[model samples]
Target: MQAKEIREVSCVGAGVIGYSWALYFAMKDLSVTVYDINEESLQLAKKRIHESLETLIKNNVLTKEKSEELEKSIIYTLSMEEAVRNAQLIVESGPENYDIKRQMVEEMEKYTSIETIIVSSTSGLLITEICKNAKHPERFIGAHPYNPPHLIPLVEITKGDKTSEVVVEVAKEFYTLIGKEPIVLKKEALGFICNRIQMALYREVCDLVTRGVCTIEDADKAVTYGPGLRWGIMGPSLVFQLGGGQYGIAGALKHMGPSANMWLADMADFKKIPDEFAMIAQEGVNEELKNRSAEIGNDNASLAEYRDKMLIELLKLHHKL
Candidate 1:
């Protein structure tokens, strides 16, 4: 079915990610049903959704009345049958266990229509493995969204070995309709794109700290005040192209290729974390948190609010909002 033909979307597992997905669909005026087994989790998801809507209103992204109307479009339920009933799309954000996700797909297939597209929010697990037990594996695909799906625009649409090309296109259209930048992977890979890049950078950061090259706070400051700013505007390849001065990427590669290759060869290549490194990493994080706690008061909710606000303003500057 075309994305425009999809009116109802089901969100299985109403945690932070699932709830954010539901909120995004609701804001787009699509009907959303969120299903969770735990009553407390459902309540918490409702509360977070309300708070998120208020944040959007305060940021001038939506009017209060419109936000209220959108909120009403989301229906919370415990019954899997009710959740998938009439749902054109189902986004699964349950636990990350392979067995659990496979089982969930098997169960969802029993109720959902044969044509309904089911996507998983898994960060690293292979979509082909996750859908192995699916009744209609052709209808299964991976739609991994970055955290806070309501705010983030990038959604990685990955295909399993058995996923149909038509299903991938439909999923891409669906995410685009809901105001997301959907990137389709030609082939499936663990961690998709964003997380893979994230881990590459994180690995270097950890290595640097372990070697006493810089403190965690200093490393963070370097990112926030340096390349991170440029990365926010454009990707590294483009940045390198510009860094080439009048010659562009060709000249830059010719001049720096040897040094870059040397650095790459010398970079950390550890397959497993050492116990000492783990302890140091934990201590460094604690120290950084303690330092920030003095000024931020250690309230996670407040920190998250601050983060979302900053992200919204950045999006606005980039003409994304």
Candidate 2:
């Protein structure tokens, strides 16, 4: 019954996502080997991980000795075989090119054992298509993490048509054991689950900006001060359920439907604006970042700190619950 067999983790690309993955795995006390073809990029990746660990330590998120131990737990390698040979979980973070993904997965399958789970950190590529040419398509699945994965908790676990359900369950257990929140999708789509939801909200925000109903700053404030806080505690469904009171969604809809329709209408008008919304949106984003850069950075730092502590607390509470 112990299909939660992940022990060593290997990341094939030592870029931002790869480096972040290495940090997450190593922080979980699993040995991680990160591979990159270019030696300079590999070194930079290692440096970035160390720097982040240092930040964690300085912020009291991780103790100095603990950070050192985690740094020692990770190894950087150029040889793909050496990186993945003993790894039970291998994350492919290469560029989003079909040919490259095919070649890498093919080469990886040649060396990785049958039990090893191949996870794609791809953002857009379909899971089924990526494994179309993989030798062990049964073992290949999508374990897409949010940006700056070391800090974010959500890992969207998706499977292709050929992927085995057992593999998905095992991946979920492995992620849970490593202190991540895994949301499993019953089917695979273009953006999977999280990204699709993210883009839907993003499109609306874009439209809101184009229509001049609110400035770019107003849109972000709408989220950070509203759903963002609630979403931090619970997902959208649960949060809305709580907002619904005892009558559930039906009751809430009766009261809120008119406002929702108005908001949707305003959002729809955004699509009619000439593509000039692109420049406005970009400018708005940049301006918001510039204005809140320092505050946002500090907030992120504190949030990461709180996340680590909260995960520990929740794990302890889970037994009692």
Best by TM-score: 1
Residue pairs with colliding backbones in model 2 are none
Candidate 2: Cα lDDT at 48? 89
Against the true structure, what is each candidate's TM-score?
0.93, 0.87
Model 2 root mean square deviation, Cα atoms: 3.9
- Per-residue lDDT of 122-146 in model 2, one digit per residue for the tens? 8878778888987779888888898
Candidate 1: lDDT over CA atoms? 0.88
Across 39-93, the per-residue lDDT of candidate 1 in tens digits comes to: 9989999998999999999998889999888887789999999999689999999
TM-score of 1: 0.93
